[model samples]
Target: MRNKLILSVASLAAAVSLTACGASTTGSTSSAASSAASGEVAVVKVGANPVPHAKVLEYIDENLAKDAGIDLEITEFDDYQTPNIALSEGSIDANYYMHEPFFNDQVKTKGYKFEHGAGVHIEPYAAFSESYKTAEEIPEGATIAITNDPGNQPRALKMLETAGLLQNIEDDSAALTLTDEQNPKKLKFEENQPEILVQVAKDPKVDLAIINGNYILQAGMSTKDAVIVESTEDNPYANFLAWRTGEQTDATKKLDELLHSDEVKKFIEETWPNGDVIPAA
Candidate 1:
């Protein structure tokens, strides 16, 4: 909400919902891949989430991008759908939000024309609780809130399975839905939008909430605060800069450099600690 271009996650969900029912933006969109004359610079319009994605880009925009002949015009979106829509419609040059699995799912399901640049960082999913000190302390019939979207549900479930709540997970497929057989603890599963999971910290009924890494930071908590944290080893969820396939300009390429720079790595480590945000290995 600090940025003028930022939209709240709730409003983003509602706006994307309306667009799904035949209200998408029209016309061919273009990436910011521009070329500048002498003593000038190329500007690349980027779409991102407000919490960390846009924040990261803002750092590059101020600290590193200008020296590389690239200027970033960051537009923040609270929800995941708008950046892709804007990218396909040429509203922005690129986006810096989703990891590979979710990004691939979106491309596969929505048939969007997009390609990623390079890996940036991983926002590992975690299981958090206010009442329970550890996973073993969770009571039977405890209610848990998880992401309902196919792109993230499986990840949340996988985290729970790791926390010893459920099992019999066939694969890491996002489409897998649980049943009584998978519910060993008999813990009630409540599926809701990802953004709402952050509210579980203030709610007593939500014994264990599977929250995304981004929202966890917004709530002023770290992965170390969670009852169980996701393993970072070979994590497939490293978020990166993305744009239309074959449309990456020189400026966008420079973005990849700035994103992977040592400075950015230090920024991430200093900005977040205790594995709250892990730079892609």
Candidate 2:
């Protein structure tokens, strides 16, 4: 009877232990299932400028991101330089404010291992003046304020060449610094930070100011208001999405697709009906 009691007690203990093990396995399986469900959503952090870049991303986050199983985290940068820095530093997953030339220059000069998607839109670089109503009215020897950045300086010079404001303009690469011979009008070029070109445009002393389209919009000025606007046809300055090379995920690709979607195109059209910003071809 003593042996029987001991055997029965041991059997009961074994049964309890087995039950506890089963419960633990079940709990783990349930938790894993929950985690798998949550993993379907991907969070993508992007840096952009305020005017159109952040606004466009804001539209996607509010309207489309949830359905695509993406959560867009947008950081707005007031300056042009910081977005790429943030992207390179891993502070942001991607950026959307730079055009092809600027992107290429940043990658080349800074050695950022970056890759870009198709052009999403074009903000035509434009020239604004407080004193002149038309490009033809820009006087000889006038002081024109332009961006000092290498990528955009060439663009501004090319536009001036097109307007017949400057002569003997070299190719984009060589036009960084103009010689006295290139200056038929003897126009003095005042190089300033791109963001402040709007103030230069507003200054009565400055004869002309060529400003980036994004900055134009931020200052509540329209491309239509400019005396001279860069042509959109065969334009190579379309801004697009960019990310670190080999680090691009499905979420970033989805965001790029969304940026070129019909809905986004329509949003840009209706938002800037005067052709301040055009969808890239």
lDDT of each: 0.76, 0.77
Per-residue lDDT tens digits for candidate 2, residues 201-277, read 87888999999999889889898778899999999999999988987777787889999999999999998889989
lDDT of 2 at 207: 94
Candidate number achieving the greatest TM-score relative to the actual structure: 1
Give the best candidate by lDDT. 2
Q: Which stretches of candidate 2 lie over 4 Å from their true place?
A: 1-39, 173-176
- Which window of 10 residues has the lowest lDDT sum in candidate 1? 22-31
Clashing pairs in 1: 29-89, 29-90, 30-90
lDDT of 2 at 33: 28
TM-score for all predictions?
Answer: 0.87, 0.84
Kindly list the per-residue Cα lDDT of model 1 for residues 215-248, writing each as its tens digit: 8876777888889899989887889999898888
